[model samples]
Target: MIPASSGTGLPVAVNGIEIEVIRRGAGRPLLFLHPGIGIAPEAPVLDYLAEGVEVIAPSHPGFGHSQLPATMTHIDDLAYFYLDFLETFDLREVIVVGVSFGAWIAAEVAVKSTERISRLVLADAVGVKIGDRTSRDIADIFAMTDTQFAEMAYHDPRVGQRDTTALSEAELLTMARNREATARFGWIPYMHDPKLKDRLHRVRVPTLVLWGESDRIVTPKYGRAFCDALPDARFELIELAGHFPHIEQPETFARRVLSFAGEAGVPVTAVKRASA
Candidate 1:
């Protein structure tokens, strides 16, 4: 059991799986959904957001320390599960923030849930399948060198540090399992929903599509497509960053996210104070 940090730990059953959730800070709730692979909401990128608003970051059923179901399949299940999660917590008027695969789930939640979401921030998100453009396949990504992985996953090379050679066997196995599970959900054709782009028009909430200008993995073109689909959305590109700009450029990331959160009516501090 990973001990709770700032947010209290709560277990909620979704589709028979008990999902571990961490709630931190105070004020309007902002649900943070993490990307697949080694990324977790507890990562530094998300930790910065916790300082401003009440943040709720849940480990997807098959990632992090969360329980993985024996027969879980497809990303849609995750979307439905999160809808139930919000209902279970009686969370209304929420601001949804999702990164990478988490952003896909957030989009699904926005579409499927009956509850109202005030705003959405999809950063380096993948959900809609665009024609002609090829997305980074999971199998291909795993075969890349650490430096190559960094180049594909981040616009900035600094966020690509990995020293897994010293990891224990158990830790390595766990990582493998997480990757396998992620593939199961995210490996569909085009790495996105073929119909999702058309469905974006249905979402009534204000949306902000954030992208790393140097993101070669998903490409910034897709980001513009995502922004174009939303009825009330705009796109912003983070310079000197890559796929995971939030991590590579935390201060800039936090400022932009907080600015969007503020516009979405999430009560929080003014601009984030720069580090000394």
Candidate 2:
């Protein structure tokens, strides 16, 4: 059974598995696919987006406290699950925002069907093979020590510096589960879907390939190539941020995302401040 903490999102069964989802604000629905670290709507980026557009944040099965079913092991499966989610909820002309691994999921979802997604944003997304075969594709999150991962993932390493002594057993378990799920879906492909680049050309939705200029996990160069593959996409870079610009610079990230999503007038300052 998934731990009670997964209750952060209302439970909804999809693809023969129960998915934890939380909705915030009230307006046109905006589906937010969070990073592998899991969805916690309290994050400032969600709040800011919520101020203007309804934000639907869900914990991917196997991450956070969400139920991990035996059948769901690949990223492609997740893309299908979210496709069902959109249909189940009857959401239309939706805006989908995804970051990091979540961005990869969003890409997979977009390529399969943009029927529900009108505006798509992939922030420092990883999931396409690009550049010379000899070049490093993506930094292995599994290989990096926690500290090292944070250093490469965040422009300010201290943002992820943890005081292990302070965490309860439940907190530790949640962290472990998040890591396990990441490895389960992302390890074998080592992050890129060999065919995703080709499928991207079929996506007709307005797309923004947003990247943290300092991202070490997947560099901006890769992001540009990812953008170039899409028929209707533009690449935008965020400064002073690494892999997770939404965490390091919420205001700037929100501004860029909102602008692209057609909510540029939304006052970013009013939303409660939080993190990824």
Candidate topping TM-score: 2
lDDT string, candidate 1, 183-238, tens digits: 78866553577666666656667778999888877778878877777766789999
Residue lDDT tens for model 2, 127-213: 888866877689888888889988888878898788877999988888889889988999887887877877776676778889998
Candidate 1 TM-score over all chains jointly: 0.85
All candidates: TM-score: 0.85, 0.90
Where in model 1 is the C-alpha error above 4 Å?
1-11, 38-42, 133-143, 169-171, 264-276
Question: For model 1, where is the 10-residue window of minimal lDDT?
Answer: 267-276
By lDDT, who's the top model here? 2
RMSD of 1: 7.2
lDDT of each: 0.73, 0.81
Cα RMSD for candidates in order: 7.2, 7.5
